[model samples]
Target: MVKFEYAPAPESTAVVDIAPSYGLFVDGAFVDPADGEPFKTVNPATEEVLCEVVAGGPADVDRAVQAARRAQDGVWSRLPGRERGKYLFRIARIMQERARELAVLETLDNGKPIRESRDVDVPLAAAHFFYHAGWADKLSYAGFGPDPKPYGVAGQVIPWNFPLLMLAWKVAPALACGNTVVLKPAETTPLTALLFAEICQQADLPPGVVNIVTGAGETGRALVEHDGVDKVAFTGSTEVGKAIARSVAGTRKRATLELGGKAANVVFEDAPIDQAVEGIVNGIFFNQGHVCCAGSRLLLQESVADEVLDSLKRRLGMLRVGDPLDKNTDVGAINSAAQLARIRELSDIGEAEGAQRWSPACELPDRGYWFPPTLFTGVSQAHRIAREEVFGPVLSVLTFRTPAEAVEKANNTPYGLSAGVWTEKGSRILWMADKLKAGVVWANTFNRFDPTSPFGGYKESGWGREGGRHGLEAYLHG
Candidate 1:
């Protein structure tokens, strides 16, 4: 067999202008951190330092919380619903205008393929604002009783995987519900959040309406534990989610967490083989499998297991693993060194635990953190890869003999975040959907997201929804 090589098709980085260092965005302005500790953010694709960002500490969190409270009590709370909606509309439009720049910046910071950031993340981020923008004036008819009030100040901590999109998920709804927010973007990916702060300024949004504090987990903890905050929204690890729950357990703080997952994508024997194979690849390999609700476990019916695995392997080989800026690249670099280490450790465990590990022949870039699209066969329910969330470009293949077995194996884990069912039989799809213990179940599809759909998890995957009408409940008062 002969291999074909293609020329590099890289997107321009000049679209994004990075400053030497960035400060915290508070009260409609960028301010230096009080404690003055700064951290450098890098491009995971090249390991080059992009810019220095302020490491927001407790004092910074307090200041942001106070600003949000002031906005909630003074200007933002008094703004009429329709007027509030107009602001969101303005934001959505501005996001659209800067979509390309934001997408490129997102790919730079998050190490995801430029294609995904441009096509999926940026568009969805804008859409989230647009979807909730319409709801601002229609809260009375939203089935949340008459005249639902906003939670005073929401503290939102988003993960690094989908930085800007997750920010949109938290900020758009909270603002639509008339709540003020203090958001902390993950330390590794703070540039886009700061750019969003500039967008807020361009929209002429009220000072303190949306404040962004950038830092690591400690900053998030401070924001979540801040007494001035009335609502706590987080998207990260399950351990951190549980900690947030405990911290706000007896308090009046309303918390919504979107955490980890070890999702199962079940392909029945009667399913379209080609479509199921594509779904399997998309479910696990998209975003380099960094997604929280990623279908990391592929469950194929025993009868069709060999055929599906062959098809899946062939498809995986075709995936481009290289520069994220290259439009043709399918799987990009891992988000960070720490994350790459974790993926390596987990993949090693999968091999050590007596599972057959396989990856297509692919050459990774020399400078960046890269992990090839990998899958394990002969995986049992007891295997570490099947049980734990590797959160990388890794998939575990398990076989089931019947529909009952598939359902049983799918729900066998502690996670109930998301699941996928692929079957030509509509009845089996519906039955599996009902039986699977997950918040979101996709029939004949996988990893599909929309601004108007409620996306979240059950069990240890976290609580509450982040999209649509149900998402508004998390930031509103009864």
Candidate 2:
């Protein structure tokens, strides 16, 4: 039989209309920052500058917070839940209408595969709005107590991995709860958020109800430390989360932080080998393993360790890593040079610490930030790679002799965001779920997310939750 291969199926970039430069989305309009210096956001795939965006300083943040507060007091807070729901529904519908453009833009800006951006990120974002729209008029039935009140203005900071999705996760719930917001998209991935600002306007959302401030760490710090913000929601590094926690320590503000994770994908000896292998690949390789809840730690039963490793390696060899715009690409570019350097640093340290590192034979683009799917077979709990969050397409394998040992090893890390278990036995699955100390536990699947399900973390991973009715509480008070 002749071998057949897919041709390059690249998505058209003509759908997205990017501006030469962008200003901060304040109140209801795009305005230049007061004292902020401008910076260019580049595509990590080719190191090409995409566009210049204003860096929001304390003054711009204050402006945004004041606008949000004014909107909360003047219009949003007084609006009926049914009326607010209509706005959210309109936003969701408009997002659906512009879904293709949004997906292509996300792939270009974020350097994630087009398929994932199109299928997962864009749709889930719209789903959040749709889900929250339905919940807006039903908050009384929610268990958060009757006569729930909006928190006025919420300050939100999101990471680069899922720009539009995180914005939807924060903004949708806050707006649905009748609160206005000031959102800070990651400096590297602000395109979609800026585009979403246009969507809010298209939906005829009231001015100041949804504000997006784009910049680097300093801007995010300003938003987090702003005095006018009644609630703070952040999704990023654990270090930043701790700082925000301290920033609001003595204030009247409430915060929900979704931080880092070093999750374990536990595979039992009785697991269906083929299915388990698939989950193993999906858990760590999806989004180039930039996921906060990525299963970077692979806990295999010693009995089937060799078999699983063999299968996993074979499966990884088949992963296609190339242009983000290509529909056939399984993996794409890393978000930035800094992230690539960090991944390389941790990977080198893993090798120095005596873990047997292995990667499939694959060619990476010379110009872009890329790392092949890699695994360290001789890794142990003591290994740095096994303990710390690599935040890349890297997996550290550790073996467990028994069920109890697997649970102990899985929960050993300080980060307790998520964990996965694969076993043929139903009793074993439940036992593992109960035993594992994590906020989200998946039994047979991995990297699965739903807008209606509440997601957050334990310990240093995060505080509070986002998604579902649980997410609304952070933006409201009884």
Candidate 3:
């Protein structure tokens, strides 16, 4: 075989100017945390130190929540909905203008391919703001009754996988509904959130309308547990989601959680094989499979299981897995060492439990966290890899004897976040969509997200939707 190599086409790092250190963004300004520890945020792709970020504590969370409360009770609450919408419009425009810079910074901090950060994450974030901006003055007609009111203060905690986008998902809707927010970006990817704080400043948004607190679980716990906050929004692991649910058990506080998923991608025999293969590759490999709605379980009809597996393996071999900055790269570095270790642990268990582990021949960079696009065949529903959320570039392949069996296997897991159905038969697609327990089902596609669509999960996948008109309800009271 003749090998072909392409020239390096890496994105320029000069586009994003990272500061040596950053502070918490509270009350619309960047300030040093009071008696708080500082931690380093690194580039997962290179294990290089990106910047020092403050680790907010209970007191810091209190300060942020107080600021948000003050804003919600004063300036923001008094502002007209049209005026509030104008501010969001300005933020959205600023985000669009600085999209490239934010995209580069996100890729640096998040270790996702620059292609995704640029094309998907950043744009969708801006779109979210744009979409919600129009709803600010129109909430009365959103079918939430004539006088839907904003929840006073929202304590939002976002995951690192899609930092800015998740921030937009939580913050945009809250602000549009006239709520003030104290947002905590995930510890590993706090830089972009801080940058977004700067965007809020540029938009001249009211002081304390949006506050950014950078920290680990303790800071998040304090914020959510604070009595001052009227609403809580979180996107992360299901275990933590359950913890948040329990923490707010007796409180009057309302919470919305978008949690983990073990989505099943069902491919029927009548489907378009090539497109199905592409969707399968994209579902598990996109964002290094850090997505909450990743199609990690491959459920192929028994008659075509072998053919689909062969195509999937061959396609995986051609995937470019290296520097995330490379324009040609298809798969990028794993988000962090801890996530990579977890993926490895689950994969090892899969092998030990009589499943066949297979990965393409791809060279990983020596200095950074990396995992090849992997698949496990002969995997039963009982296997740990098949049951748990790996949150990495891993897929578990299972054969299904019929449509009923596929639905049964798909709904067997505890997660109900998302699923994919690939079939040319419209009736089968409709039937599968109705039967699957997941919140979002993609027919012949996978991982398609839109700001206009309501996205969330059922059962253990968490409560409430994060997009479209339905998202506003979480931040409002009738």
Candidate 4:
């Protein structure tokens, strides 16, 4: 018999010593907001005041843009691509060194399970830097012109879900390609990104190479509309993505949007039943189904629908949901009150729209914002649950008589960021992969991501890839 010892989840007693106020990062140092207004970032899980961060209005945005513009016109853009690659390499190494601390902060601020922050989120963030670092100097061979230039200054806005990882995705490649960045992390989860600002300083990255301005939608609007920025990258909702597209239309600022998704994980009759059950759990319940590419819809072959559903419910029943810091916890609190409301409203709509709703029989914590892992059966293509991005631990189950119907119903949504096909048949897997309209399709798996693989969507899911060689293109100008 083999024995394994598990380490207890680490705890942080050091009070989050966010100064009475945090200022915007400009020219490699923290400074007051140009507009002189500030906002407090709160811990959604406990509704506690985490810190007061700078609320950058138009003036602050202008200053941040000016800083970025200067860096692009001066040292950062002038640095050799190989040297830029070295900077990214150092950031990646530091990210690994600080993974545990970042994971704790992530769980505290964003209310996601620490296991995911430590195991999935932090590691992949570093991997993204590692993966893109190699491409900094090899841009000429990446299908672009032999001498691709950097987009002057990238104005980036990222969502609260996976805060640090989004920062890595947006900033790493921009830095690797020699473009300075003005990044606005989502208001609710600004802690990690602000900490990342500290890491930039520790790595000795050039001032203005990366800047963090923390605020709400208005902050994002200022950054996007700033004429000095050359490109804009946003990751959030479909409605917001379209609005951004319209906002930047006819402007010199090129934009890429990685928006919402209602991905389908299809289980054919031949799928490994046990494996499919686990995949289904991970697809929808992982991160409390806050994932944009969550398998919100489960398209099971009619023959095995009952069997798969039974097994899935059984597996879901065993999941532990509680404190995010507990390594054994499988799910965590909803990121915010607004997100919880949205999930509840949509789940209510699912029931009103005549789909049968089911949740595991578990006693949820009375304090933090929480939702039980939920599923809807008898869902039709016309139901709101089937069409809308619930973006919670909610799954809609529908059956298909044939593979064509599976693909049809899977791609029926306006968004198509990702999808999954589960089957033992090699030909069926390939055929399904070819027919699916999503940007990422997993065969015999669901919700698996690698830094080296490209990720994004086909339609309303948004444009441009996030990882891999293709990600570098977003920062380069012809």
Candidate 5:
């Protein structure tokens, strides 16, 4: 095999203009909160301060919720389905027009590769709007009965892993269903959300139709608890999801929570070695494994486990883990210092619990948060690493002797978000998919997503779907 070297291809950051400070986006205007100081957002890769943003408090949440309520009752609710779709279409076009700027800003704040931010995140965000735009006028045919009604004002909170993409997932469907929204982006990655607020203004969307509040957990709590909010949607840890569930229990408000996962990627003895190796690498390393449904557990049939591990290791050795702006960088920086600390702690526990850890020969930068692609072998289902959501570029290797045993090991977890199977036999693919207790199952691939597919989880992975037609129904009551 020939080893090829490439030149540095860094993306230009001149495209995006970041102000020294920003305020809460409320009622189609930027306003200062009544209390709380401004908080600084930084580039995780360089530890450089990107910008300072206002920290919205309970009062701000109330104001935003009231704004959404006003929009839902006034302009947005009275607007016809076709007119609503026209607005969505306009927003979609504006997002595409500024795609490069959004992608660069996302890379600066979130520490994901510019290649991914440009190619995957921005494009998919626009796709969600485009996909949902077509469904706007035709929503009566969405199988929710003839006269499905909107849920008034939706209060949404999203995580930091895929900030822009998650916003698209939650906002597009809610808007398409005629529900105005007050959305809170995770404190760590709020730039793109703020930028989206500008996009809403550029599209000339009616006032109060979309509100963005920038804050921490307390702000999210306020939004979830606000009486003016008719619905709630949260994407984060299971602990927080449980709290949100309890907060809205037996209430008139509706809620959808998409939480954590410890997904398993199973490889059979008859699977193609090269493709399986690629799938295994992609499962746990893409976006530095920050995905909620990432394939962190690799279960191999014992008959060929050694050979598969060798191939996987060789492939990981070639992965480039460096500057996110570089087009050739395969893996990028961790999202934040706290997340990096958590990954380190869990990995140390895995080592202490008798797992053999290994990584490719690589040098890490000293300035910022970074983690090499790591794998632990001789791991069992009983190990904490196999059961926990590490949410970083870490893989735990486990082996089973039979198909029934594989099923047993995969289903032993508390999460049922997703699982993957790799085998050539069509019959085996169908059989294993049937046995896996997950919301989404993939054959010979992992981590592939689309706007047309419904994505969610079972068990502690949380409730309700977030894509396709099922996502639209989550915001409707009648």
Candidate 6:
């Protein structure tokens, strides 16, 4: 068991130069927005203003897009594969050296627990860069013809949940495939990505290879719809993803989306109850359930529901909830006020739809957005909680009698992004793995990710993979 050290929570300060309220990173340098409009980015835990970030309007995105075009035309696209690989290796090394600072920045900007930002997000982000760098010179083995070429100026829009990690997932492969990039981080969580621009400069990467534009939905639309961009990669709500799909339709733009999911984590009677309970907790509440592939549904065998719930509830009660920077905190504040309301509205819908609701007995922060770890029992396949992606630390519990029933319940949702199975029987694990339609399946373990693994949905979850050799194809075309 990992013992979380309790430390005194620190107060918020507005004037710390430790992190910058950055502008758009254009041509290896930070530049002010063309419109001169700036927005304040706040620390969600205390609602303290962290920095005044420049909001990229259409003109700023055009500048960024044009810069990316120039970089792709002049340098990155024509660079030798080995040289590109070396740049990625340098960035990966820099990421590892500065991992701690990036983690704190991610937690401060995105409102996830510090432990996750440190242990999961930062390391995985670096690993992604390392893994993809190895593939730069070996694109011939990637099964996409003998000679694959980079798609110039990829316009990638990533989510607030895993800012730095998602940036690596998108940027690493694009760089590996020899594409310049103009990425827009989520409005709520753009700090770590902006900080990454400094890492690029430190690595001595050429100008316009990466540009970070910070703003809301309108900014994302401006980027994707812009003619200068050759490809669009997005990770966010399904509604917005579909809108992007429609916007890019009839155009020659290459697009890929890693959207929302309502993943099910099944615990069988033969499973280790304690371990499964912990996996369940980690799966759903790791980032306060702000994950796209979060195991929001729990399908327990009828014979062991009581024992599993007992173990789960006991474990839930012991979780520390407070300031994100506190190492002891298991549950942190919601990313934004909008997300908190969505969680609340969904939980209320679960209750109104006749599902029993339960939350961990814990106090939330007095300021900023907060929601306790929640669970809903009596959730049928028809329940709103079962069907909808309540992207919060809320779990929906359902029961099943047989393996067939378990698979049936697990595959009931439109999303096939991810699923988890906990069982002592090896045969059952294999059987369930074949049956589940999710892009990624976890047998016993949940929410585990590696840089070399392929991750994407099979159905409405979206098309294409984000890691492994397959991830390179999205940015490549001969």
Report the poorest 10 consecutive residues by lDDT, candidate 5. Answer: 1-10
- What C-alpha lDDT do the candidate models reach, one value each? 0.93, 0.93, 0.93, 0.88, 0.94, 0.89
Give per-residue CA lDDT, model 1, range 234-285, as digits (tens): 9999999999999999998899999999999999888999999899999999
Judged by whole-model lDDT over C-alpha atoms, candidate 4 comes out at 0.88
> Residue pairs in steric clash, candidate 4?
none
Model 2, position 194: C-alpha lDDT score: 95
**Native-vs-model 3 lDDT?**
0.93
lDDT-wise, the better of 1 and 6 is 1
Clashing pairs in 1: none
User: Once superposed on the true structure, which residue ranges of model 4 sit more than 4 Å away at CA?
Assistant: 1-10, 13-20
What are the runs in model 6 whose C-alpha is more than 4 Å off? 1-21
lDDT of 4 by residue, 1-478 (tens): 1223344564563533455567888889998776847778776666778778877899888888998999889999888888988989999999899887788888888988888998999999999888888988888888878899998999999999899999988988888888999999998898899889988999999888898888899999999988998999999999989999999999888898999999999999999999999999999999999899999999999999999999988888788777787787888989989999999999998899889998877778778789999999999999998999888899999999999899899989899899999999999989999999999999887888888888899899999997888887888877
- Evaluated at residue 463, the lDDT of candidate 3 is 92
lDDT of 2 by residue, 1-478 (tens): 1223679999999998899999989999999989898999988888899999998989999999999999999999898999999999999999999999999998888899999999999899999999999999889888888888988899999999999899999999999999999999999999999999999999989999999888999999999888899999999999989999999999999989999999999999999999999999999999999999999999999999999999888888888888999999999999999999999999999999999999988889988899999999899899999988999999999999999999999999999999999998999988889989999999899999999999999998998989987878887788
Per-model TM values vs. the true structure:
0.99, 0.99, 0.99, 0.97, 0.99, 0.96
Instruction: Count backbone clashes in candidate 5.
Output: 0
- Misplaced by over 4 Å in model 3 are 1-4
**lDDT of residue 398 for candidate 4:** 95
- CA RMSD, predictions in order: 1.0, 1.2, 1.0, 2.5, 0.8, 2.1
Could you give me the TM-score of model 4 versus the true structure? Answer: 0.97
Candidate 3 C-alpha lDDT tens digits along 1-478: 2335878899998988899999999998999998679999899989999889999988898999999999999999788889999999999999999999999999999999999999999999999999999999999998888998997999999999999999999999999999999999999999889999999999999899999989999989989899898999999999999999999999999999999999999999999999999999999999999999999999999899988988888888888889999988888888888999999999999999999999989888999999998999999999999999999999999988889999999999999999999999999999999999999999999989898999999999999998998988898888
Query: What TM-score should be assigned to candidate 6?
Result: 0.96
